[model samples]
Target: MSSAHALMLQGAARSARLLEETQAQWRASGDDLLLFAYGSLIWRPDFEVEQALPARVQGYHRVLRMRSRVNRGSPEAPGLVLALVSGGSCRGLVYRVARHDAEAVLTALWAREMPTGVYDPKWLVCDTPHGPVRALGFTLSRRSANWCGALSDSELLHIFQHARGRYGTTLDYLLRTVDGLRAHGIRDRELERQARLAAAHGLCTPTI
Candidate 1:
């Protein structure tokens, strides 16, 4: 093949190799775990989960803890990150897997939730009926104009209560959360109260 054709062929080969490696990683991880969804993932079930239930995790509060990196991912990109709002506690659901499926499960979740370094990963303790579940979480990286420290309770709820994105709006996410919780036969008072406060405070206003 010519030099130009050779280079192009090499690049394609490398891309295919990377994809194979990624799939291998997923298969190796097996199943039986999941990262909680305190934010947008609650609404968007892009990643396939064995099962999801309303459960609490500890040491992190659900803060509007992310910088909105629109250019990186959205309808335009693919992945999305609602950074961990630091400095508080977050309560959300614990998605269960098959114990040997962490690799594939996480990769899928990352594709849907965190496509790139627009947001980084963090380890948090999850409060579950079984016990504290350690899982990976997606949060805003320190690389964006929208990067802001964890927003206060009022701020978080306000954003979700009235935020919108390319795929949908903030209100849409909140509405989904309400529905998801109800489906689990649970009512998240904290989230519900935050939604109320967000409405009262007005979500359209600047939260960060």
Candidate 2:
């Protein structure tokens, strides 16, 4: 096989193994499975959820600082996606999955989010209106190859204009995320600022 194709297969195998390990760990813990959603998961959770509550996770905040090579952008002209980086706090939704359905739900989640094992999945304490719940959250390390760190306005504008993947454009993803957060009465000023930047440049119509 070609070298690039072989690397892709290797990444896929690693992702599968990681998913299996995570599932085994969760099963052994004997606790309810909770998923923390901060981005597209907030709008599109393709699994059956027992309950979804507005949750805030401390010590990590959301930022559109990851490169999407398959879902939201191409490899050549990569687009940005959200990830939970260290420091600050994040406001999003936490989904509770019934014990009976956790396995199936997690399998589907792995396929969607861990296609190449780009994220580090961790069990985090999410504070909800009711109480604190331990939830599975995806975080990205700054050292990861997919980490975008920080981008200037020109870089973002270029991605907004050119990047497109199997799912859709990066601009659409950002707009949708901002809309989802707004619907939950969660105000993320930084995300809103990016949306405004896009609108100001006439890249997309304002939705927030």
Candidate 3:
């Protein structure tokens, strides 16, 4: 592993501590906790949720702008993942965890998402089919060390083609995320375009 990877992994303990602090704050509220899912969380929340409903978050759009150096790639060849960057709106899911299980659910969630502390977890308003609900969302900072911002089609294709990490290849992560969105009746045109381009270039197999 590269020194960059080692440096990123060093934040794991810090991330866990921050998550615990956040959990404590939530516990003090005595209310059901809601989590917003826009990417992998939609398909692989891994937490026991009481309800999952179609929801929308405004002022932020889903884009493949976050760099993954562990779960989906390496230091030399990082992979891309979706992040809620400022602008537009995103259609996704809002998961509600029971007040009783919130602590355990949050613990597991942090273990999965806060490995490198690249995302800023914040409370955002979600427009659900039922009604508007405030939910905890993991938002990306353009200033964050892990932010990849925008990349050209060729760059994305190269990473998707060659990058792999402990979980799987970058292509696998993208395909699964797109599939997950489709399963929820949401279609992301940008992601679709990239996936098609990658397949045409024989970089990655088309799964959409």
Best by lDDT: 2
Rank by TM-score (best first): 2, 3, 1
Please provide, for model 1 over 123-199, each residue's C-alpha lDDT reduced to its tens digit, 9 standing for 90 to 100: 56776777776665654434554466545765565445444455565555555566665666656565566556655
Residues 1-208, model 2: lDDT tens digits: 9986886797799788889888998999897789999999998998888899999999999999999988889879888888999999999999989999999999989888888788889989999999998899999899988898889999999999999988899999999999999899998998899999999999888666
Worst 10 residues of 1 by lDDT: 71-80
lDDT scores in order: 0.54, 0.90, 0.85
Q: For model 2, which pairs clash?
A: none
Instruction: Select the stronger candidate by lDDT from 1 and 2.
Output: 2
- Candidate 3, residues 48-103, lDDT tens digits: the string is 88999999999999988888887888878888778898889999999999998888
Model 1's C-alpha root-mean-square deviation from the true structure amounts to: 8.2
TM-score list, all predictions: 0.56, 0.95, 0.91
lDDT score of residue 102 within candidate 2: 94
lDDT comparing candidate 1 with the true structure: 0.54
| TM-score top scorer | 2
Candidates in order: C-alpha RMSD to true structure: 8.2, 1.3, 2.3
